[model samples]
Target chain A: MKTTPLAALHESLGARMLPFAGWEMPIQYQGIVAEHKAVRESVGIFDISHMGQFYASGNSVADWLNSLLTNDTGKLGDGEGQYTLLLNEKGGVIDDMIIYRISADEFFLVVNAARIDEDWAWFQKHCPADITLRNESDHFAGVAVQGPKAKAAWKAVFPDCDLPEKNGILEKDDWVVCRTGYTGEDGFEFFSPADQIETWFQNFLDAGAQPCGLGARDSLRLEKCFPLNGSDLNESNTPLEAGLGFFVKLDKGCDFTGSDVLQKQKSKGLKQKLVALKATGKGPPPRGGYDIALPGGEIIGQLTSGGQSPVLACGIGMAYVPIELADLGTEIEVVVRDRRYPLEVVKKPFV
Target chain B: MNVPDHLKYTESHEWIDGSEVVTVGISDHAQEELTDVVYLELPEIGRTVKKGEAIAVIESVKAANDIYAPVSGEIVEINEPLGEAPEPVNNDPFGDGWMFKIKTSNASEIDELLNADAYRQLIS
Candidate 1:
């Protein structure tokens, strides 16, 4: 199995290691609960170098980007980034991504780690003559310092590092800083050279940032009702159906892929939408694919992501429910461990 | 790593000792293997459990495991603190991490448990 620069560090710290995607990533360091609490209460550092990064540059970068993503690139100024999605002609999500416009002719695209090969191939096949795509996945490493105390911890490490002025990006030599994160918390993501990543990770730890693993990461993201790519959003899912239509630019006047189908769906209204639910009693967090039952005990939907909320002291989950039952405060039931527990539809942020 | 010399161990990885009644808990190795004990469903305090019967369920991050009864007996007491913070099993599995106490029907059943050296070899 592949390993990152921090592989030895994780082993030295007695991390529970597990195979993720293709890399042996740390599942937990001190413990999942401790790491989860640290991120929620103070600061936690995550090794995100396994995620794929790409640089798209050339004169046709703007037109090329406009042709590919569902969002309008015309509105993005230099040094700004936006969350967007790549869609197929059938309006299926190819990969949700973030686009960083570094300059008029240069942009940085960050895609999901599991979709590296597919996304790279798609960018290569669709590159316009005026633009070029460079795969920087192996050359760059990313680390995230996240939590309420993240800014303070990060400032101690890199005192000169410009605070994120806007959406998730800070400028450093050969490094890109962004205020974006999968966990619904205030934090900064540092993108730097692969070799220098270990140094940064140690620096963050020296500054008392707890080392968190994917286990804590999942709980944190689930607490925020954020969607995981494979479990929550897939090729069969559309942003409109997933309650992410705000990220789609159907009226941006750009003839991008999947625009027609998305516009048609928008006019007709969504049949299904992602909704957050909280379990009412003591029970395990609803697992993905667990049945969501109606008042009459009829199965209606299934959870895509679920976990115990360390902060909420109960089970919480996110799933696609039919539009009729998607209203906030709608009471429902979740079948977990062969038993049904009362649940209620709530707002997106379950925290 | 801290295997109390006074306590006997089972091959299934539980540790046992006798006070007025037999006290049972998972070994340190067991807790380390199942890191971050989130929720533990212990058996009823007065219920009689058979040896090797599933008496409790422990859930970690994404996995759930059945904790078998070490010796056939009536559970005299349960650890209520685990419901609020099961991490003690991860923090002090041999001491304050004791799961429950039971009145054994037969004292000879405790003799079947392995000694410290044998229990260490079983895990190693």
Candidate 2:
């Protein structure tokens, strides 16, 4: 049970604590559905301190990173970030990350909490002599202030420091702010020294931001069809299979790790794809690992992430099925607790 | 944490009223803990179940919860509307949120359940 820098603050607020990614993170404060609705309609703040942070700098840092990650670092301007993936030799996703070009010769990466050690280890094993890599996961705490009013919340806290534009990063003394979030809302991620994160979290709350938890965060992202690294993505699945091929650049003028396999998969046609599913009839909400079957009860795959959408008031989820059965409007049944429920394959961004 | 004096409770958080044919529902403390009640499944009207057996299920936004049989009995009726909209489970767990009614096979089994005071202490 690793604790975040603001563990005590979460406890004081009557948050339901749960173990996630090896951290005793808050599952909810007021309630998951209430907190979820708060983020969709208003502003909500979340503790994202458990995620990993890394800094890389070198003479040809852009080229070096392009050789290691799926997205081309050359495409990023200074202070710009893009969604990207790190892949193993077989094109299986190691982790999905947001890599930013801090400057011409430097870059910063934010990665999943559970993959911190593994991502850091992968970077170390492939480090070229020219590049300097630093794992700063233990030194920083992060918060995501999200929703339509996110900018107002940010303005209330750091009025002197202008918030960056979308997918942009701005760094100050011992702190960094990025216009990024998984909730599909207007938001920014604030990363500061671990000791000062509590103060910053409180400031946002004082500015009328609702303090949310991981439960709401999961539902919010799922509603938007954001693929969680360990759930929709895995060691055996490629980003291409997860419908994240937009981030993998095969024609970036240089080949990177797992690029060859991705090129092959692209040319030969994909075998499976991650697609969204919605319950067609009323029943229990679809959840992860629930079997997805044809109308006749032939199992094809299982849901990777799912829950009832608070906004839509219907069961929604994502699943990886064979490409043949992954088209929009494909009829599927999700077996929940030994009984099949009517489900339909649908388009993403379910909200 | 509201435990009505007339209702009997189980450690699993179900509440029962009546002696022969009882109305069963989840406790307030239970519903409060399992917030955001989304959807639920009720056992068939004629299904017989044993005491402490998981006979029904409730799904919240976070996870699914099993609703157990308070005593060995046959289910006489189910709250079917909950299968569509489950907000009542969180809003009014004891009244409209009542899950089912059972015809007790053994009346003596009801005596072993907790009273309002004991249920309160169990949650606290």
Candidate 2 CAPRI classification by DockQ:
high
Relative to the true structure, candidate 1 reaches a TM of 0.89
lDDT per residue (tens digit) for residues A1-351 in model 2: 799999999999989999999999999999988898888899999999999999999998899999989988878899999999999999998999999999999999999999999999999999999999999999999999999999999889888878988999999998999999989999999999999999999999998899999999999999999999889999888889899988989989999988999999999999999999998888789999899998976898889999989898889999999999988899999998888888888888898
Interface RMSD of the predictions, in order shown?
Answer: 2.2, 0.9
After TM-score superposition, what is the CA distance of residue A321 in candidate 1 from its true location, in Å? 1.2
- The DockQ-derived docking category for candidate 1 is acceptable
Model 1 ranges with Cα > 4 A deviation: A168-171, B18-23, B32-36, B43-55, B71-112, B121-124
lDDT of 2 by residue, B99-123 (tens): 9999999999999999999999999
Find the candidate with the highest TM-score and give its number.
Answer: 2
Here the TM-score of candidate 1's chain B is 0.94
Q: What lDDT tens digits, residue by residue, belong to model 1 across residues A1-351?
A: 768778888888888889998898998888787898999999999988888899999987977898889888888888888889998888888889888888889998888888899999988998877788899899888888888888888789889765765464656778878878877777878878888888888888999899998888999998887778887888877888877877888777777888888888888988888888998777766677888899767898788888777778677888888888889999988886667888888887877
- Residue-level lDDT of model 1, residues B5-106, one tens digit each, is 898899888899884488888999999777767788788889998988989888877567888887888999998888667878878888888899989987
Q: List the residue pairs that clash in candidate 2.
A: none
